[model samples]
Target chain A: MDSLDIVFTGFLISALRSATPLLLTLLGECLGQRTGVINLGAEGQMLVGAMAGYGATAAFGNPWVGLLAGAGAGVALSAVHALLVVGAQANQFASGLAVWMLGFGLSAYFGAALVGQQVTAFDSIDVGAAAQWPVIGSVIAGMTPTVLLALLLVPVIGLWFYRTRTGLRWRAVGESPAAARAAGVSPATVQIQAVLVGGLLSGLGGAALSVDYTRTWAEGMSAGRGLVAVGLVIVARWNPWWTLPAALLFGGAEALSLRLQTADTPISAQLLHILPYLVSLVVLTLTCLRRSDSGTPAGLKAVMDR
Target chain B: MRDLMLSGPGRVVGTTLAVLMLTGAFFLAIGRDPVELMGLIVRSAAGDGYAITESLVRATPILLCALATALPARLGLITVGAEGQLYFGALLGTGFVLANLGATSAAPYMAMIVVAMLAGAAWALLPAVLRSHLGVNETISTLLVNYVAALLVTWVVYGPWKSAANLGWPATADFPEAFKPSTFFDSRVHSGLWIAIGLAVLLHWTFVRTRWGLTLDVLRSNPRAGIAAGLNWRRNVLLTMALGGMLAGLAGILETASIQGRLQANLSAGAGLSGFLVAWLARNHCLRIIPMSLLVGALLASGDGLQMFANVPSSIALVVQGLLFVAVLLVGGYANRLQVRRG
Candidate 1:
């Protein structure tokens, strides 16, 4: 392959890897918002999960256990968020900010102890062998199993959300709590479940980043992926179906940038590094400007004001 | 109805107890004694004149950032991008100081600070313009700008602005001691402290006793009410955000000139977030910001001390701060529930 081809191919492969974390977090935030809670602590939860995942993987010598531990940490952190926002009924923004602070601090503290240690990364599942065709095989060659799992989850979750009795209650609770209450559904219970599920997914996202992608944990490794996920939730209009493609688009931008940097492109590499965020910003602005067609949950903060 | 609420002493006791109990729980979890941690925190904060001075030095930028958000917050506005404004201020301030290297100390340094404030105010104008014109959400715009500012600062440090004198990484040259604020007493505490305090008092006086303050207070609680009272919401929003941006911008300038003396890739070190925390904890009350700023400063100062004495990572303090913040919000929320029930 020519240099440009090789670089483009690499970018495509890596974008899948990069998109995993974003996808996980965005999916999680989607659930949280669907139930009328804006859990801004996704960043903090991811950070904590990253640290826990790294720590557990390091101690147990198994990536699976680490992933579980990471998800547990995410859930614990999210529980704090759920308690404060759902149970205590705090301002969503205020509670979310506080959770972010706690997560950033705790991760750094725990990270101090685990700094410089290396853990085994998860092995990628080969889908190339199953593809039975060259072009498709090449495209799916190094894609992690987590990406496939997360992608599959979108449709299943979407179907479950719209078709199931519980799903109807979830929507009702988010749309109008008074109506939900009158309909004999408890908003608090529904919100708590959404938060718990969201936290689990967020934790899984952090775990994927630490174990499957980065292969090593360091302070602030999640960077602003959690926030990016929040932005994606806005752009996707809290639709799980849209998040998958949005994640791919964002991941693709990041991958493209890294590719350009590696290829010695004349463009300033710094500009490339910012491409994903810029794209998201533009996408968000345009999305906000356009007419809304996808049904946004009534309880979700993004649409509640409108 | 108001009389039944906590009295002044009761509120102080409540806030203190809330802070302490939460801090204690965190320390206890980490296998450290809360009393010892608290003592170490207090002593390290005031263990020596030098330590106390350092705390004040650290606090200079924090106080500024707190006021930045609090100013808008008092008017029921969320200036979530104070961090970005701070960067705009610091970047301009440093650029001005470096560009005017030949000028004598008196005019150039002061001029740089003034320009820094203007740059910050100008940076804030983008969000204000968007909000007033297109009806954009200030929170998201401000946040997006923060990312842009961070990237902009990164560009400056890493690109053409990279110090030609050094080759390995991006960093600006150190400011001359004459241009920089002087350390007060063998610590890095500098004139930024006085500047921050002076600004705080100025803001307090402006918001509490002045006509503008009354107008802002009215606008903050009820924008519709302010409009009904014949206050121009747009002008007041612009002015309040300007003041808020200026404070944060001053923080960035002070941080560069006094603390770091040179701009690095990540000069903020989460001061912007800390400022948000301080503003929230104070509930946007200008006068209350002083003690909260000091308290946060002391905790931050002692984070280093904890690392030094107990071999504990300073980030542990962050966990404590997070716990306190979450707890405080929960309490506030609980209070809201009580009010709802009573009503």
Candidate 2:
């Protein structure tokens, strides 16, 4: 292959790698929002997951166990959110912020000792004969189990949301709790379940960051990806299928930024680093303007209306 | 029984006790003596004149940021963008100082502050306009812009504005001695404290005594009636958001000029988030924010002392702060539920 072809292939693989965590997080948040619960604490959930996942891997020497620990950490944090928003009827936004702060502090406290420590991390799978075939082969070889799982879950969730009774009930709760309750579908139970699933996916995303993507732990390492996932959900218009393209857009920006730092370029690296966040902001604003609440869950509209 | 528990004093005492117990439990979990550490925290935060001043120094930015959050919240807007506004403000203020590097006049210093405030207001206006004109959620928009603003600051400090004298440190040149804000009582506490306190009083009066206060109330409680009463919701939202942004901007500049002596990355140090928590704890009451900020500021200030004396990571303070927020939320939520049941 030519130099240009090699560079393009490298960029595609890196984009997919970077996009995996965000894809996991967006899918989780998308599920929760579908149940009429807007979780603003995904960032916090991701942080705790990252820290706990890293710590667990270092302790147990197993990446799968680390992933489970991360998911459990996320569920533990979201339980607080569920208590506040569903159980006590506290403001969802405020509760989520509090949860974020809790996660930030707790992770920093517990993970302080684990900083700079190394553990065995997930490796990209070698896809045998397909690994030698052109661009697609290179991409397939780059896919770790977590990455492939994240990709697979996209269609699985999409089908579940549109092609099942449980999916209809979830959507019903998101649209109108009162109506759902009248139909004998408990909005509270559905919301709690959706939030837990959101937490689980977000935790898995965080674990992916520590155990799969970076393979090292740092304070606030999730950066704004969890929050970015929140914006991607809106940009995807809450559709399970559109999340793939939405995450790739952000991931591609991140990959390009990293690539630009090594290449001869006039643009400052810091400026390039701003690309993903700036793109998310612009895309979110444009989406909000164009759609003007066309596909928003009515229950969410009730929360954000004023 | 419900009335007593929901009463003002009852709520205060309950929250305090709950926070203390949770903090104590956390210390125990970490294998530390809860009682000794709690006492140490309070003493270190405000035991002596020096400790009090240090806390006030920490409280200055938090007070300003709290007011920033409170102002927008009065009009029913939730903005987590004060951190961004603060950074943008510091960036512009530093730009002014960098441009007029040789000048030693008080006029330039004042002008720098104004420029910073304007920059913060401009940063805030983007989300305000989106929320008002397009019905975008202010919380998410503000949160997104925050990342952009912080990156903008990072870009400048590491690139165009980097200080060569610092020998690779990603910070701007130190403010000229003439540019530094005057300190108080041989402490880091500066005139910003007075400004924040004065602004709190002014805001409290405005909310209680002025026509604008009632207008915000009408708008918040009933937008249709407010519109019928000729109060412009869009204009009011823009005004509140801009004003809040200006205060947060002032905080950024004051912290840069008075505390750090230079513009650097991560300069706000979570002051914006802490401020938001304080404002929420105070329930967005302008006057109540004063004490709440000082209290939270004291808690944060003790982190250093905790590290030195107890050999614990200073981040334990953050854990305590988070516990305090959860404690308040639980108590407040329970009280509200009781009140609703009683009615």
Q: What is candidate 1's lDDT per residue for A1-306, written digit by digit as tens?
A: 457665556676788788988898889898888788887788888998888988999999888888899899999999988999888887777787788888888889887878888897667676645645544455566677666767778888888888999888988887899999999999999999998888888988898888778887788888778877876787887778888888987899888888788889987776677788777767766776665636567666443332
Q: How well does candidate 1 score on lDDT at residue A281?
A: 66
Give stretches of model 2 more than 4 Å off: A1-5, A132-134
Candidate 1 lDDT tens digits, B269-319: 777878888888888877788888888887787788778987778887788
- DockQ for every model comes to 0.58, 0.71
Candidate 1 residue-wise lDDT at B94: 81
Task: Determine the backbone clash count of candidate 2.
Answer: 0
What does DockQ come to for candidate 2? Answer: 0.71
Residue-level lDDT for B269 in candidate 1: 72
Model 2 TM: 0.97
**Model 2, docking class:** medium
